[model samples]
Target: MASEEVVDLEHQNHNFHFENGPAAAIFSKATLPVTLKFKDVIYKIKIEKPGKFVKAAGKSEERTILKGISGVVSPGEILAMLGPSGSGKTTLLTALGGRLGGRLAGSVSYNGRPFSNAMKRNTGFVTQDDVLYPHLTVTETLVYTALLRLPRVLSKAEKTAHAEAVIAQLGLTRCRNSIIGGPLLRGISGGERKRVSIGQEMLINPSLLFLDEPTSGLDSTTAQRIVSTLWELANGARTVVMTIHQPSSRLFYMFHKVLLLSDGNPLYFGKGSAAVDYFSSVGFSPAVAMNPADLLLDLANGVSTGENGEDQAAVKQTLVAAYKTHLSEIVESELTDCSAEPPVAGDDRTLSRWSNTWVNQFSVLFRRGIKERKHESFAGIKVAQVLIVAIVAGLLWWQSSTSHLQDQVGLMFFYSAFWGFYPLFQAIFTFPQERLMLEKERASGMYRLSSYFMALTVGDLPMEMVLPTMFYTITYWMAGLKPTAGHFFWGLLGLLYGVLCAQGLGLAIGAAVMNLKSATVFASVIMLTFQLASGFFVQNVPIFIRWIKYISISQYTFKILVAAQYKVGETYPCGGGGGEVCLVEDFPAIKPVGLRGVSTAIGAMAVMIVGYRLIAYLALTRVGALKK
Candidate 1:
């Protein structure tokens, strides 16, 4: 945290040098000193006004999130934006970072130029919530990020070296082997996790860094450490900008510049030590000794009944008006005096979007997906779910003779029905859970959506299939549906095919709804309707609604299972094998379709598989999964 404690990726010889070609080119040079400048940055969005009556609910209004925000953050200085909730702290930060979308009226430039791919390559943005894979160790997390984010000019070993340097700098070596963890699972501490998040962005040695609330949800000591690290990083001649909420006194002084905001208005933009004096001159200074961050937040929130005893609304109005009248001119004047001039369009900026080839992207994402999903796919609870259901169903229909045709038919249908919905529920949570991580990576151009979705499709399949294989391995011989290996595999294929279709359906519903509760209910209704039309519940479905059978994955899967395990003319002696009644080919419970229709039924499910998954992918695009 002190000057002596700086981690020298360039000076102290960390085995990798910044002078080394494109692989090492990502390291901050401190020579291309970036000066981030924004003038009159304004943002707004439309929201519907809540109405007492349903008919009036469509009435809309424009809500302004930011109003005429202006600031400058030069290299060797760390700028902190201070505000209470709803003061447009994040909106302004996002605009400065070039990630905000909508009707934005402002200009942001790097060294007095618009954002280009070159700036994107050297920029790092850290979201407030740490979006990380929980099962991966800290070392693994950084290593993967380095691989995906670092330019391909670096060898695998070189990327590892970069990661090691960051790990050492962030003091994460102690917890390098620990998993990142989540709410249900426990691994590293929160501060350590926060450090890992910061470490991820620091890997590229970015010239410009934007972090949202780097100190939120942290203890004072931990918060201080994070700010101190950023301070050291900025002293490396990397312009660092972040949003902070109610920082401690010691932590508040670490900032080189403070931009205060209230009600979408910039209250002050100047040195941190000068904030109190500025506010005092503006007639809102605190009367008692207190943390500057607290006083700033209080003033920003117009906390009344304090030393001023002025009306809160009036205080807020006065701050906004005073800032516009005084500081706005100063902001523009400073911008005018800045040494950096606007860059001519397409003159000297280096252009870069993706660092790796698409093939390599797929490979890296596939490998990472495997490592991240192994636990969720085969966790004790999920395995137990499949095993318990298999055991129960097998025991109930355990090795019944062919005479009990109805019970055997029921067992086969159970295989179709269970797998149909089991995988559906499991797959529904996949897209929703990864939404945060996906958006974060995509916004950073870490990988393409196609590559990521392909990896997800391929990576999850092999592991997902294991559940059905385990279930059938236990229940197949136990239930005695078919004895031959050929029959066993055929039935297994049908079940797996049905699983894929159901999973596709789940993915579509999840992407479209995006809410777990709503997706679950919608899927429940749809699958139940399919089950009712599966021919086991009733053969005489109404003609008007009979169309459900054609689109019903369970119905087609049931047809395949029946064809695989039964012969068209086979008869089963009923009444305890006494031949009181025989289950003929025309039995109401089983369709008379033979193996000849297997191809047709499989073709139908194949269509559903592709159709549903295609719909799912498109729905993901609609849900803003792809970079926009």
Candidate 2:
């Protein structure tokens, strides 16, 4: 029996291996060698300075971030960029990786040809901070990325196999099922998260990989492991360029070449092993125990107290001039040789911006959105808030009678305002929170903007509808407003539509600003404007300012709820006199003008929904495409 149990266990392991076998083969066979070369790359930014009291206020200055930097990174090489803060290592990497925005001087090429969008498709970039969905498990994260990024030519099984292979390759199999948690939740460690980031880029089987401080926040041991992984990747014939600060001696030795920068200027660009010798030739040498990376950085930044005892500025000048006079020729020679090589023959066409069709993208993104929304902390908070508000409102206006017409009308208006304001505020954080992830995926050509927008809209609808439904169900019976089935159903529909409109407006605000604080301030201003013009607060509007009433969704919702309760033919007791109260004649405030029927109010709400969502989609697309 024990032997049989062991056999069963071995069979399960065999099945797992078989499932991921093809993916390992694909990773080994699919990569193409790419050599990246940059020449005289200069990057500058325009900054506007607030002029002093007497000077012009809008004066602008051009700050150069990268000044004529040049280098070549061949296949099977790992180039480490060492520099102090603001030394242009990141700027240079961004430029070389095709992520830099604005105008850049000089040329960057891939495999002897001018850099094109095609090269970008074949390249990968790992940002310093890992931006991932906090609720997804490691395997789920990689599977989704594969589904969205892998070529359409591959089957679903093939893609799953590939994702699994990446999990194994990155040494993440042990924690594959663990959730990627954030500050609010418990999950994987920082090192594991960084590996996940690397695994995400590896999904494409990229030839060129750029990482911005992959080891920035890791412990020394973890940092060495990450660098070792890069070293292995480089040995596999991939070109890896990364910016690192103060690495250990073992990590420094793993790099094939090093580019030392100081104040946007290259002080040295050569082999990692020869950097110490070059510095020694320039009258600076470190002790045997000193980390070469630290020594180089200190020398580049003019902080090294060498044998020459030169001034800081003079030391910087000496290093920069030495590179220009001696090492620049070597770089130029390599660049010329790389540029002269012929292109590799094959189908080198660029991948499409989206791997999946629009429908598929929407479907996948919708599923992802639903998963994220279901696990979000705010979802529970929203339900709690809804229940609390519903109970409070119900108690405040308990079993309202027709004799108290003012309180009933005020209650209906309050319902409209509550639904409107709540949804608007909830949606303001949506786009801002996901902006970084969205931008990273979009820049990598993973999916279209429209697919994401539609998916988000559809996914949020079910959750969005649930809270309002709960709110209305609790408040409707408790307050005793128009208990008839027709009236209750129509009121529910109107309330739901009002919630959608408010949420759409919030999405637009979030997308437009892409900052939580700024979006909140802007949304608050708009919400206040709409609230004041909702017709409940200010029924008698001046003719010149009356247009505001037409644009206020709250006003439309209030009109619908009142019309649903007090139909044109129905009459109720007015005040305590027991006289007939006709809605059109008794209460001018609740009377419907053009928004008399349930259909008209529903139609207006639908229009607002489409208009605001369209604006939000456009704003998000614009922000996502804006490169810095």
Candidate 3:
């Protein structure tokens, strides 16, 4: 099956020439080529010892991931890093792409000069997993990326044209209008999704492209086509660097240069085809019909023996020494020549930052939020859950007369607590799931953190309004609460505010921990704490902890709902004596605090929303910077 797939891919490549596509036309409008060079680059990270309580303050052992690896990749060439698992190929690629964060020694230059944020703007990096919105159509995804990434010089129409060109170039015309769906929803194929990922980076026509396992999870033919497309891209005077696993000989020979690594050290770095000859000189020869990439991996893994009767380790040592003596000199000489040349001047530097205004970013993110939520949140299951819960609660309370004022209070408190818990739990997954994508874009300087936060807060309002409104509408009339429109509206407003506060708290928890499981656990603890202090379950005040109620959104929401249902002048039959009972005596929970008006409750909720969201934003900013 794999062989057949490979043949089919070759046939497709014959029929579909990437260089003849609209993307080629787009790339033909040239900018100066990029040359990326890294010299003696060493990247190390700290390793914390577990269960070592006696360790000194601010101290930990350090382990190097990449040790003094050096190489140069010039425009119009493809440099592929090949090695065994745990060999640091991806780390080296990331380091060259300027994405790795840690203690580092050595220099990486672009166009014969040190790298800057401006240079990264003109560079593209594609990760193994495609981080795209599954709900957005292919065209819509590309269009949005173009809007956010393209320069202001390009008009809306021009950006749209560019997006269309990229779609055509990637051969995604058939699925152009199809959603990029995932596990639950059916949408584009895996190969098509990979192409869409590539197309996003291509929208900006980057001068240098870096990919980590771009062909992973694809059949041989699909992988070949991807590499072939990348080759065409390189032919357009763009530098291409990627880390790849085992490749067929046909695919292996396609790369202009190949760097073989073993244990974070370079074993060989030279022309891809010349690798065979270089190894042959080091007393290592491939058997007849053996794939060069396979042989290289075997050598790097210390699983192969050489003709000189030495084991794999000795062979690797010889190869590394040979490359240092032969290939390293060539790379250094080339870097010197390239450095003598002057740098290219252009306005491309400014494009490194956001291409759109703050308002524009907020608008784009707002639209994205709506589209994502429409797919993930408004499904039949979610609506059914809300309706079922509302129905159950209403049935349990069952239209009690004012005589059963205790039951009414219980129902209102349940309403407040449930809304708070449900929304908070649901929102905990939001930031953790998007952390990788957000980190990537943020590192690229795509948009401000504040813009994204505000967009999320505003975009969620409509959907947030929906579930609670549906819930309250069914329960309010069914449970036989106050029937006046004024009562219903105020109660609904109070519940909506409760949902906002809960969601804000969830965002803060999610942002602070950067892990779904941790955030969920943390949010649960917070919700439970709020519930205990909400004034619903416990009325007696332990003076020392009574202040907890001031910070409980559930408490305020309950107060507002109770006040809305029972007016100041209203009276209810109580004490089972057919005597009228005053509102204050009937519900003593809010009496001490005076059961304030709806506005006061709302003001408190507003404060919670702002405070929690501010914490969320700050947490996200700090975590994003701290993440490697």
lDDT of each: 0.82, 0.80, 0.80
How many residue pairs clash (N, CA or C atoms closer than 3 angstroms) in each of the candidate models, in the order given?
A: 0, 0, 0
Error of 2 at 130 (Å): 0.4
TM-score of 3: 0.92
lDDT of 3: 0.80
Best by lDDT: 1
Worst 10 residues of 2 by lDDT: 9-18
**Candidate 2 runs further than 4 Å off:** 1-20, 26-30, 52-58, 307-310, 338-351, 575-585, 592-598, 624-628
Candidate 2 lDDT, 1-628, residue by residue in tens? 3544433432221122334457654345325678888889989998877666655666888999988889999888999999999999988988888878797999988877765555665688999889999999999899889888775656678778878889998899999999999988898999999999999988877778999999998999999888888888887778999999889889888899999999989888889999888888877777555878889888877976555566888888888898898888999998887645444322224223445678877877888888877876356776787789899999998999766777888888887888888888889989888888888888787888888888999899888888888889898899988789998998898788888899999999988888899988888888777778877677677889888777888888887878777766555665456564654434656653423565766777788899999999878767735332
CA RMSD of each candidate after superposition:
5.3, 6.9, 7.4
lDDT of 3 by residue, 1-628 (tens): 3544433432221121244643345655325578888889898988766555665666679898888888888889999999998999999888888877778789998877666655665778888888888889999999988877766555677778889989888889999999999887899988888899898888877888999899888889999989998999999888999999998898999999999999888888879999988887876777666889998998898765445455767766777787787778887776677644345333342322455679888888899779887766788899999999999988988887677777887788888889998889878888888787787777666677888878988888788789889999998888898788998998888788889999999888888887888888888887888788877678787999998888888888888888777767667765577575665534665564345556777788898999998888888878744232
The order by descending lDDT is 1, 2, 3
Which portions of model 3 miss their true places by more than 4 Å? 1-24, 52-59, 307-312, 339-344, 347-352, 580-582, 589-593, 597-599, 625-628
Question: Which clashing pairs does model 2 show?
Answer: none
